[model samples]
Target: MDVYIRSVNVGRPRPGIEPRGRDTAIDKRPVASVEVRDPGPKRGGLGSGVVEDDVVARRHHGGSRQAVYAVAREELDWWAAEVGRDLHDGVFGENLTTVGLDVDAAVVGERWRVGTALLEVSGPRIPCATFAAWMGERGWVRRFTERGRTGAYLSVVQPGRISRGDPVEVVSRPAGGLTVPEVFRGLTGDLDLARRVLDAGILDDRDHATLERKVARRTPTDH
Candidate 1:
């Protein structure tokens, strides 16, 4: 629908992007150019990255499923109004800030063509302690969770260079798919919606396994 990349952000993270916080690569700043790396299908799955974006928390971040983090610029504007402060593009910890795209509503299996690269929607960004600390707002995690506008995490399907102003078009989407917001809420106590993600079959194995484990843990025992 004519979505375009608003800003390409990467991070040169230091030990202390924030005092008393994890060395998250979330403090992304705008970059003039970004060379998206897909690693090809034989290598496994999509992984998008610019030259400057570094991964400090390797254990929890930087995999095929969570390759690139994206948030719609409109959502950033919404947070700006709600928090009574001006929000900038990179301030939300997004690697690629998009304009005119409903990121939260994007289906998990959906693919987008950006520049010469192709990216697939893996899932939504689940808020964590690092994200909470970055915001520095009281009840930030709860608020963000309730909002359910969690940004999408993308996998590079076809690796190539991508930069700001690149046109984004949906290449394909799963049939009767669940949206990003649905998956986010499902992770956060919504069993019905969470189960739907399994049915979609487009999510990464790691994420799908996580949900499978959770469901197993909650299953009813024989009476």
Candidate 2:
């Protein structure tokens, strides 16, 4: 399917803990490269795409990379609709806003072409306090985590410049029956769903191990 960027969003760094309290005006910036790293510091390599030795994924809340998510396209729209605003209003903190892509359905290892850049769906972002703060609600993070619509994380498969209004197309679908949504649910306290994905056996080794461990921890007998 043809994908396009609906908007390019970036939050002017705020001074305090207030999520929407931005002291500076929002500005557009080109997406250098999207990344998905294991929220855990124990597993520190880039999850699915190109990574340079110097580029270390920022860690939050004690090595939880999942907390800070970059939402894409339709999912961004959904987030905006939930807050009664557009993504450009600085609600999502997304550096690159995209459209015309079913980001939730994209599985890990899948590649998407946007202009000269190619991005792969690496994993589902884990929602955090920043997300709740952005939405201006106390329980927004929990709600998102429970709902499993945290959006997909992407890694740069091909280095190229990306801008707003660029068209994106899915060039690959990796071998998997579970979608990004399924994986999100699996990670966020849903062992049954994780088990289903494991049984399907379509996930890559990394995903499979992660899902299995999560499931085993949550529902030992099933694994």
Candidate 3:
């Protein structure tokens, strides 16, 4: 089955997308289109082969694990009402703005054949100060987190051309794999959910090490 790619966006060349004082590239805008490619081993990172895109905060974003970010048009519509304003595609700095897709509900390890590319759901986007500033909503970070509908990040499996209006195909989904939202709570110190994220066997060793410390601080809770 195919889904609609409402818009394909990339970071426009701006003073910066990071908060006023920081360095990052989170202010993405709808591009007429873009070329998507797999960076493969030993390249820049997630945002690597994805041409014309920006990821100034290299330490925090990009890599094979987070090659692309996706947010559903439906989620943006919900936020528009919440803020009492109109929100557009790419407002959340997403690489792909899709329609007719419950992106957050997608299971981790799910593969979507978008264009000629294959992308696997890796995790969720963590709300950050850059995001807050971009949205121009005070307490936006807290509000977005509370919504628990964070967008998903994907890793390029078999990269190819992607453009606006491309249809997305759900090639396969991992049975019982962690979901994008669960990954969000997991990284946010939700103990039981964090354990589930860990058991999903998706985290890189570096991520595992960071979560290990948090896992120690929180007592186990019933799932």
Candidate 4:
């Protein structure tokens, strides 16, 4: 199954929305490229720029990927109603807020073709304090994590221009027993689920390494 973007909406900080402790919300604006940083303090988190392939290193980091998203068109009306407004002029922080596809089901390593662009599912985003601050809900981050509705991230496998209303189709589904939601749960310190993802063999080398490390941390000696 594949998902397609019906529209692309961007959002910036609104009036009276102060940047609370550890919160960084900027005014909504159009960007040529959206950066996805790893947010790790070490490993010079900015490993390499996906758009530029430049190795400008930094100690304090967050992963940044050029924002490309897919949403179903039919759901826009519902989303607008829930948000209490129309989706134009950028209100949602999503660079690409989409409507038709099941956004939550896309798994890592899965590839989708949008127009001439090819995107590979990379990882699930970790909700941050900024998101909570934006929503004015103190526990929003925890709640979102608990709900496990965090959106999937995609890395440009074959770079090409993408625009609103582009049709998206799944070109390939990588061999893996676990689904996208399973991977997201695993990243949130769910060891048993992580084990399932590993045993299922859906994880690539990097993911496999990370999961093995987690398993080792949980089990000091081989079982």
Best TM-score among the predictions, by candidate number: 3
- lDDT of candidate 1? 0.79
TM-score of each: 0.89, 0.66, 0.91, 0.65
Q: Tens digits of per-residue lDDT for model 2 on 55-98?
A: 22243211222222246666656766776766552245544566
The lowest-lDDT stretch of 10 consecutive residues in candidate 4 is: 53-62
lDDT per residue as tens, model 3, 1-223: 4477989888744664456666556767887677777654323555544778877666667777778899999999999999999988888889999999999999989999988888888888888888888888989999999999988888888878788999988889988788888888989968989888877778877888788778977766779
lDDT of 4 by residue, 115-140 (tens): 56777676665665445565655576
lDDT values for all models? 0.79, 0.55, 0.82, 0.53
Please identify model 4 stretches exceeding 4 Å from their true place.
1-3, 9-92, 198-214, 220-223
Give a tens-digit lDDT track for model 1, residues 29-105. Answer: 89876887743331333323555577666555666777778899999999999999988898878888999998888
Please rank every candidate by lDDT, starting with the best: 3, 1, 2, 4
Off by over 4 Å in 3: 20-23, 40-49, 220-223
| Deviation in Å, model 4, residue 119 alpha carbon | 0.3
Better of 1 and 2 by lDDT: 1
